[model samples]
Target: MRSETREASKNVLGSPLRACCHNPQTGYFRDGYCRASEGDMGRHIVCAEMTDDFLAFTKSQGNDLSTPNPDYNFPGLRAGDRWCLCARRWQEAWKHNRAPKVVLEACHESTLEIIPLSVLKQFAIQAMN
Candidate 1:
């Protein structure tokens, strides 16, 4: 593989944590990197495990990710899937007691700039390496 290919396997923090998931798509660049840039207003850095409650919560907020959008190449999401979610959205869910389990290693480091590690640990997916 090329150097670029190998480098993308690492998280935004420069660690070799496995990608969050890709079946339903992820990453700000859609490369499964969960990376952020100036253009990414949402700062999608949280690697969250999907659940029915969280899905419903996001849908109620007007961002229905579970509904497939063929025009956008989106296949939608289902329970048990891992996704790169916007930091603020995840925080909102947490505030409303609907947060999902987070995969720390898979999460982009930029999340630390929004929410603290302490809060993330409260909903982390323990045992992930």
Candidate 2:
């Protein structure tokens, strides 16, 4: 028997969190949402739209998001793919001028602890009306 549970999480907008990506089945739990648990040290909660520069930057950092890993079920990422990334890594990318656009509605509120909302807003893919 198997069961699935979702955390009562909120997005950066203080609203109910939304799914980030489904094509790659993102999230720390691989459930398409950017929720994180206490044990999730990586804090994979920042929902970012991939870019060529960002992918190359991350790969240089040794994460290698573009390489397919069958053992882990990772089908490799390409530009335009939406992924739940580590908050700190995103900040690092920002510092290097390679940060990808972020989806505020899909980013977990906990990400605020690592990256400021103002910074995230600067790279938001959509403007809040």
lDDT for 70 (candidate 1): 90
TM-score for model 2? 0.92
For model 2, what is the alpha-carbon lDDT of residue 97? 95
Superposed by TM-score, candidate 2 places the C-alpha of residue 67 at a distance from the truth, in angstroms, of: 0.6
TM-score of each: 0.84, 0.92
**What does candidate 1 score on TM?**
0.84
lDDT of 1 by residue, 19-108 (tens): 777666677777665665677888777889999999999999999989999998888999988888999999999999999998877876
Clashing pairs in 1: none
- Give the per-residue lDDT of model 2 (tens digit) for 5-124: 455788899988888998899988899987877767888989999999999999999999999999999999999999999999999999999999999998988889889899999998
lDDT value for candidate 2? 0.88
